[model samples]
Target: MSFDPAQALRLAHDTLDIEAAAVLGLKRRLGDDFARAVALVLGITGRVVVMGMGKSGHVGRKIAATLASTGTPAFFVHPAEASHGDLGMIQPRDAVLAVSNSGEVDELTVLLPLVKRLGVPLLAMTGHPQSTLARHADVVLDSGVEKEACPLNLAPTASTTAQLALGDALAVALLDARGFRAEDFARSHPGGALGRRLLTRVSDIMRSGDAVPRVLPGADFSHLMREMTRKGLGASAIADADGRVLGIFTDGDLRRLVETGRDLRALTAREVMHAAPRTIAADALAAEAAEVMEKHRITVLLATGADGRLTGALNSNDLMRAKVI
Candidate 1:
């Protein structure tokens, strides 16, 4: 009934303003309590148990994932379930980070006494420092916001964004303190592409043995073409009797030879092969293989051993299918 563009634009601007204020306000709130919270979490021998309800619960799960992936080792435990037997998930060596906008989530408050009784250090992320949960917590992280992004100011919008950002800050700070590296991140994300790039070696993805396309220096251009086609790498490795790579002949070489009016039927592998082709080690990372492909501007690469012998071969298409790209 009412489709005013002006109203829509006004609401969008209001949403941006609210969220921006919430994030900007975060700088002024970073105090001794935030430092103490980080220190407690860093010192804990057990995992960090993150707890929250509703929107806060979503933020809590993400915080836990970030912490775990960054080497802090954390996981989420819903406050409602904690009131049942899930509180047992919190061990003595563990630290707790509970999130609630009002600082008085019923489920969280119910487990506060039990958590305190277990001697677990409690860290509260909340808008109200004077509220019950904050008063009970050993450390309170201020996530107060001036307003909500919703026009009526009833929905949890800006508050949840502020909480999520604050959680990220905590996770990053701890990650830096522990000297967590990209290798550590890769370890936690082995199933992801980034993890594959950082962790999977060329040896793990290259075609070896009978799958490799190779030819001797005496082989004719026809043999090279057949080898390249059979191997499907768009190239054939030129190797010695001992399997040591000497050079490489690719589809590009075939084109160049044809353009030069050279007779393919009369040309030898040695006449058309690139004398020194770019190659990578089988033990090198697949990420490095991708980089090599970019550097050489080629579709295929020969994998060599430390002895300079051809061990395997890989191509851009192989990397794509492996999701290394």
Candidate 2:
């Protein structure tokens, strides 16, 4: 058998086209029912419990995460597990989002009566509106597709794509409705890079105390060089006796000084420093610090307290190390 790259590429494009069309179809079908489902989930005082089996379960897990991260508290519970002992996880105040393309999965349908008995709101995402799950649902979201991206139409491809897209749509709508901000999302995702960018403050990652490169205004060039080398921040803050930042002397300043062939030994810190350099507030977001650094075309910034005292220092490398850049 010969491997044909062109044929493989054509098949891949066809598969993508099928999935894309399925997602587009969902947008046309979205209407009052979609709005009702969003409302049902929003009105619930408890978590959104997502349940499914097999591939649907995989999609359910992602949908649960997206909902949870976007301000709707949610989690995925396998339908098979729910029948054994996990059913107890469901509360009357919670809303259940059941995913089953056919909406006829016995594991899920068997629990519908109990779900209804508990007076829990049931939202169904399925291909068949007349299926058992949808019949019992308080709100039904149509996730049906004309066909699967699979060549044989057996694999859950286009159907799963539609389901995932619809789930995202629901989450985004609820997120907007609840005014879920990036900070709120960051709070939920504190361990990720997005969290570091949104939630981390300058004081959290900046070097403080004796580690911050500093020199007295009257300090000699030798003293400045030692401070820059010891701190390894490529810059030194020129501060007064009260720890008030007066100016910044960076490596760039040093390069310019050498360009003039000036006697390095005769210069003082105040004589070469750039006065009133860009400073960021200690409590400001690390993301804001990155923006300030980028705007001024500088690599380092001196973090200042409310009274304008040099509290800490950070550079592009520090921001990168903290995953804020």
Candidate 3:
């Protein structure tokens, strides 16, 4: 059969509207039960063991991940697998979040008795409060949807969306209650770009010791250029004998000097240097270094210690190589 583009677009719009309405419907129903669910999970001493079957199981897995990543300890378990032995993973200190739109999946209902016997707090996320899962649950979260986004009104589209939204709400509520910060999130995601931005310090990627371009304030232009070339940082710190930074000179300054047709041989580091150059603490995050560089329109930053002594130096290239920019 030939397809009509207008009909297809209308169908897509209808589906989105239905799903969006279903999620919006959840807002009115959220009240004491949602708060109780959050309290139960927060009060638990162990992880949140989430279980479901079929599409609900997929949503359960995502909910578990969101919870774990956002500071709450949680993991997903298959209802069938739980009966086989995975049930051992659920301890009395843990809370069980069971998802079922019907609240009557035989695979899940069958485990309800055992979950209760284990003395674990059971939280049910279901559409049917009268169903077996909700009846046995210690706290019931109404994940009911007015309808599904499917054309046949049978698939788990709107309901799943509601479930996912509810899950996100729970995770964020727990995150706020626990005072979870970005640094804590970064620690859990160290291998990702966000983690590097938050956890990587200037000291971790800065060129230190001999690699840091440095010259005495009285050093000649040739000496400063040599130091910049040797360090390959495009900039050099002009410091005193005690290693305190006096100023900074960059390749940009060199270009300006050349453009003016100045006598380069007679110029000293102190004669043409940016006094009180942009500096960052060695312990500052690389993300902050990137910010300082962008804000000042400078390519290099001198890292200093608490004692106001030059500790290291980093350029835009270093930030890029470290994946902090």
Candidate 4:
């Protein structure tokens, strides 16, 4: 009974094997009922109100979030809370997804009649399809497992894994059926990495007005140097009188100019600028600018508006600060 490393490794492997089998079992049992559940959720005019208790409740909450974020409106409502005044959150248009391994948890079973009375569809995800919760449901999704990963076979291990897999399956199926796009998912997950890449526009992150380093084409070398130094963007855009970007001069250009042994003070902004510099539209997605920078192996990008005039300036640093890269 003393600690044994080999035995512990075997137990861990056994646990993973059991859980994997439990999830695979769901695939074999998946059929018409799963499709019906998806259809019911699609048909609903309101959010999917997921209800559960204990470990199953935790899985239910994740399912609700996955559904809600993937274009199916959904939210978790604990069964214990539903028995209380929280039941009011379930409207007539909402669909209920009730989760319980046994399908007969007292708190959950007690509320079935009331949920049915609301005239909303009830989808039961349970191991015991014959239990009261499934009997009362409009559709039954079997989340059964042959055994638990726990040594005592009492803890909700494999069963919960199966439930989670089934929930992800449901979310994926619903996402495809609804034709949900990445942009749609990004809208719901604005704080996540994908959201920043998809939802952040160039205008949102670019430096505008006085923040952008720019000088009139007629400006002297000292004036251009001051603009580039004051802005600290490592580059200065040479623009025409009407605000149209004519060219760009960067630190690289300055280094090469210094190497030529020419007097830097006598030059005008237009005299040494690189004309037809790369520019991105102000309304373009920030992700596009990242791609352009990486492809050209450059850092800075000038942003222009509809009239083809420089509107703002952006660089790899801007994209990094916005977490869009």
| Alpha-carbon local distance difference test for all models | 0.91, 0.96, 0.94, 0.94
Query: What is the C-alpha lDDT profile of model 4 across 1-325, one tens digit per residue?
Result: 6999999999999999999999989999999999998888999899999989999999999999999899998999988888779999989999999999999899999999998889989999999999999899999999999999999999999999999999999999999999999999999999999999899999999999999999999899999999999999999999988999999999899999999999989999999899999999999999999999999988999999999999999888889999997
Flag clash pairs in model 3.
Answer: none
Clashes of each: 0, 0, 0, 0
lDDT of 4: 0.94
- Model 2 segments beyond 4 Å from truth? 1-6
Highest-TM-score candidate: 3
Weakest 10 consecutive residues of candidate 2 by summed lDDT: 289-298
CA-RMSD of model 4:
1.2
Model 3 per-residue lDDT at 82: 90
Deviation in Å, model 4, residue 83 alpha carbon:
1.6
* Model 3 per-residue lDDT tens digits across residues 113-154: 999999999999999999999999999999898888888988
Q: Which parts of model 4 are misplaced by more than 4 Å?
A: none
The best candidate by lDDT is 2
Which residue pairs come into collision in candidate 2? none
* Cα distance off (Å), candidate 1, residue 116: 0.8
Please identify model 3 stretches exceeding 4 Å from their true place.
none
Q: Name the weakest run of 10 consecutive residues (lDDT summed) in model 4.
A: 76-85
Taking every candidate in turn, the Cα RMSD to the unseen true structure, in Å, is 1.7, 1.8, 1.1, 1.2
RMSD of 3: 1.1
